[model samples]
Target: MNKLLKYLLATILAVSFINCTDNFEDINTDPNGISNQSLTQMNNHIGGSFTPMFLNVFNVTPAWNYQLQQGLLGDVYSGYMTPPTPFAGNVNNMTYALVDGWNGFPWSDAYGSVMPFVLDIKNAVELGNDPSGDKFVYLANIIKVSAMHRVSDIYGPIRYTKFDDFTTTGEYDSQETAYNAFFNDLGAAIDGLKSFESDSQFVPFDMSSLGGDIAMWRKYANSLRLRLAMRVVNVNPTLAKTQGEKSLSSDAGLLETQDMYINTGFAHPITVISGSWGDVRMGAEMESILEGFGDGREEKYFNPASDPALNGVFKGIRMGIEIEAKGQYGNHSSIGSVIDGETMQWMTAAEVHFLMAEAALRGWSGAGNVKAHYEAGIRTSFSQHSVSGVDAYLLDNTSTPKDFVDAINPINNIAYPSDVKIAYNNTGTNEEQLEQIITQKWIAMFPDGQEAWSEFRRTGYPRIYPVMINNSGGTIDTNIQIRRINFVSNEINTNSTNVNTAISYLNGPDNGGTRLWWDIPGSNF
Candidate 1:
């Protein structure tokens, strides 16, 4: 096949999943064909592409629309919510189920769907010169690391042996190898910084909105490497520490992604462009944590007006007690709530700052003000969510947070205000850092429902109400949150061997109660 033919074929398979309900027998003809377009045009489409991808994958669609954020329903976050009452068996517990076998979701959409064009962009970059190629490479690395981290986090391992393969006999690789490849990609990305020396070539890469900016992409790559390394600390400490240290040692400038998140409006999912509607909202687990902190972002993330009150409210349902109707979508008075994609975000400066703060806390030596990063995270979180500052917020509090600072007890009192630095002085050990992190992350993840769930599951700090109604699986602990989402129905049929093997590692049926590799313990009633 000719070069054009190969690109065309690859493009076909890529869009095949875009979904066409009608006679789409052969309609996948590269709606955004980049091979014929220049590097600039290609980057245009990719510039803000990640916003929808991240929001969609996490299940943070507009709840008013009934669109589900895949990860939202996952047992990680809102699994705490039940049926006619709140959380039910139908909810997804991603850590256990969504990552492996057959449930790996649209989270990897960036990896499989958006990434292929990166290869084409590379060709375009090579065809051009100066900032074009360099900027593309850097952005490619940023996207690459982001996607790989998602894959590694879920499956624990993947086939990175021969990436972007179109041939036979190329199977999946181990997670460790995938991490190594991630490091290599980071190195390549870091090298793109020099490409910015020639003044950004806006012709082939117009980052004025998002892409033409290579310098920012470089920081994103480094920071992302830090995140991936930190993530693998348990699985590969030596590698994690080394990579963390390496990224820290570098002078590859650090810019928060929040400074430039995807604020796309009137686009598909959010708009009628794709002719699609999505609804994802703040999970009860998340809302509880934020409310506890009196987080300012909750106003942005959650609707202040009670849609359920207007309509009928469906709280929680029994998991497996054989219940009939869980509840209706909008059983309250009205039929609408805001689930539109108007508020979607990709990466944010706040996230970058938070990651830096985490790196500082973990002692990942790098060019950053750990305290400033910490404060940045807090302030940016407020700014991101349009939250009020600490003072005004505290005034709204019934009592100063400082009053309760020393009153609470954590699993690790040492990790409290003393060692964590950020926790120091502001609120003594009793302040609940777990809630703080989740509260901030929840805001930063505006329109990102799934990530909110992930943070909630990893910490298990917030106490939550079981459910207004229950579903069929079983009862969720009033205190202990749900563990994992059940393996999807399809996996049991196709990848039964791996599915069964994975189940053996799980405590129960790999349902909402099963835990993932990283989650801490919880009461699975």
Candidate 2:
């Protein structure tokens, strides 16, 4: 009986071992590489990819890179267009449609990517998954404010408050309402971040090389707060001052470390659509500004004058802004009329410092020196960014308009004589302040030049040169220039009511000529 029992036990053990081997945790219920969940993983991908296309940093899906196209025309900045020649058609071609197209540019953006970044921040905070949740909240507010700033500037008022509800039913919010919400969101973010003290204990998924850090996020948030305050130009000066104070105070936020900047790498350009210069050229206004500052970034930004295109017939008609004018060096298609998206340039350190200086000048209670911030802004532009050859530029200090004239023959060697006035006045008037801020901001934002046009529209400084060809309808008021962009066909068909409601707030029809409700002079005075 004992021998029989032992043999039975052994058999049972053998059976159990066989069963364990058969069940070896190889559950095919789910698979690797491909997963049911994609939106979460791809949200940052979309944000990082699409956001820079408008700014000319990198190119993704090339079908709808029109934001950069219209952005240049609206601001009168040169962009990536072929042949590098000026336009002859009416303004309706570029102004009404091209500029207006940017108004609804965000339409084609993948909801899966943009929505999750904003939503997950709120979700993770509520779920209590990480200590940096408040930082996420801060980022959420920054993202909303920055996105809205762009959308409103381009299209006019947009869906706010209920913006996150687009998954169910998105509602368009008024400019006033949007501004109020923008202010509230930033205010709350500021408060939350101030009280946030705990470091996220979990190992961060190695964004170190990418320059993602908490302190940097806070700094970028504060800089955004300052930018938003400037938008309340026509609403209430007292409120603007109050917000400005909040942005500049010791309690004011900033992306302190260099690690916080959005770094550009050779590994991948966030928004390069085409790899050749056939798509872009240097704008005259940008050339004027950089030459004025004796900026050293001209070599990388500009093409040489001896190219076959710019010499014989086309002298003043190069595309791309903040870079020098040049004809194609070697049939470079990427250097066309639009900003090159394949090029890798992101937010600059000079931008952060410039924002800090602007905040300090606004009388915020921070430890930074306002003047030093301005100087640092210039220094970084020469030192860190890809623009090479500075010593020669500074020796010239200011270049006159005639200095840019290219020779008329082939082998057209373009040696520009110095002729620009660099001493910008700080104490002239409110308009003066706005120009100084925007001009520096413009200098800081190269490669990604969409913001330059946006800033030009927002404040109307650097009175731009009208197209040599009178293509635009007389609607772009000589004084005010292009005001708002027309609503796109996509929005009219999909969100008609909201689009109409938003349109009504615009002083004119939703076309490019209308001044947004916030742009008119209530507090802009």
Candidate 3:
């Protein structure tokens, strides 16, 4: 493990230096540093590159990296969890202060840890001229899309499509352009891997739950295509239908009974962040929705609050509230055993079902019976957590999200902003049915707050609580809420020209107030 870590760090440093220069070809071809020959023994040149990409997707080690990567942004914004510790004297991401120092993790982590490895894999495969190596490139592409899409969602424009081109390394692609490129790459990967479906070349290199199954990797790619397809349905329904239908009809199939998780070989970061550091706790919105619906997954997701005043109840802190100290909310419910394992979750079968349910709602082809898919989603999630009462839970119609009550601060209390229920509303309006599907999807995708937050911003379902504090200096609205994070300081400092060009692609300013391409503000219908 120590040897592998040293190698990964050395490779990353080499790649980082090559990537920083104006001419990648000049630096890469110079061959002064770790060369392909050095890594060729035992296929380490190609196989080893997969490790960093898998690890960085959720970043397992040094827990604080994971905290900055997603915990502070997606976890809180998605209403999944809130930090008890008030960093920067309470003026931070939670309050929409737009922390440049903190918000750069998602970008830096992706580019530094994930992207370079992907490029290396592609180069190694091409230079080797082995047809068998194409499978490695395909697998790397799948992982690249999975990791880079999250980065694109965070910041509206990202350095993708032309990342390997030295002349345009710093140029940014608009969110729309990036999504199109993602679809193209996923399509190529899905098609390219079909002939190699039975191949086991990936077994020794596989770190995911799929266990080196190429067919399963194809299924994951198809499912991810479906996910990205649905993300743009509102803005580009025709294109959405085309790609969504392709995913539905693909022989590669979608993730039905299986989930995609990367075995990071380390403790889940949330455990350390919530349990050891006492920095994170369940979000108030989570408490409102889960408790209001009488959700059986509550115990599976969070532990009872440690605060003696709460008396073992599942309590959560409201985000963006005035917190002078951590003790006020430090005893709030911490993450439970769900994330106690070593793997970092990527996608679930339950989430795939919900995506199909949404596809059905959109009247896309190959999406049979909306209610069936919706119910299947709920059942799959219940089974995943080993929770019971799924039958009665499916019949729930009277329950709605409960209003939140701040245990320590009454001023932080707020009403949950929805009346949506658990039962599949077959006869309800399109918008109402979407709310039901997205709300359930949001619940089932526990702890994967990046996707949850993106869906929340895209659909406006499962109405999350707005921040009580507004610290964006009026850049971000307290009501409409934050849309996307601003471009990182690293980019502005190093690639100011491209960063300015990227800002023009945004719907508004470059701050958190700006909406991305797919975040259309209107009814679901």
Alpha-carbon runs more than 4 Å astray in model 3: 1-41
Write model 1 residue lDDT over 209-301, tens digit each, in one string: 354556656666677677666555544567877888877766675556345443323232423211122122233344334444555554544
Clashing residue pairs found in predicted model 3: none
> Residue 335 in model 1: shift from native, Å?
14
Where is model 2 more than 4 Å wrong at Cα? 1-103, 110-112, 120-138, 166-168, 194-210, 250-252, 256-277, 305-346, 359-370, 386-420, 423-437, 470-474, 518-525
Better structure of 1 and 3 per lDDT: 3
TM-score of each: 0.64, 0.70, 0.94
lDDT of 2 by residue, 1-525 (tens): 553343344334323323433342442125664231342243221122223222222222342344343324433442212224222232233333243444344544423334344554465455545455456556555655655555666666766677556573456777777777887887776666655434341112212222334444556566666666766644565776677667767364554334223222222221232233233334555555555565555554544443565442222333211212233222332322223322333355677676666655656556377656766676677665555554454344344333334233323223333232334345555545545655666766665554566555555544454333323456655334556666667778888887887777767776556777556532224
lDDT (Cα, tens digit) per residue for candidate 3, span 229-284: 99998899888999999999999999989989987778899999998899999998
334, model 1: CA deviation in Å?
11
Quote model 2's TM-score. 0.70
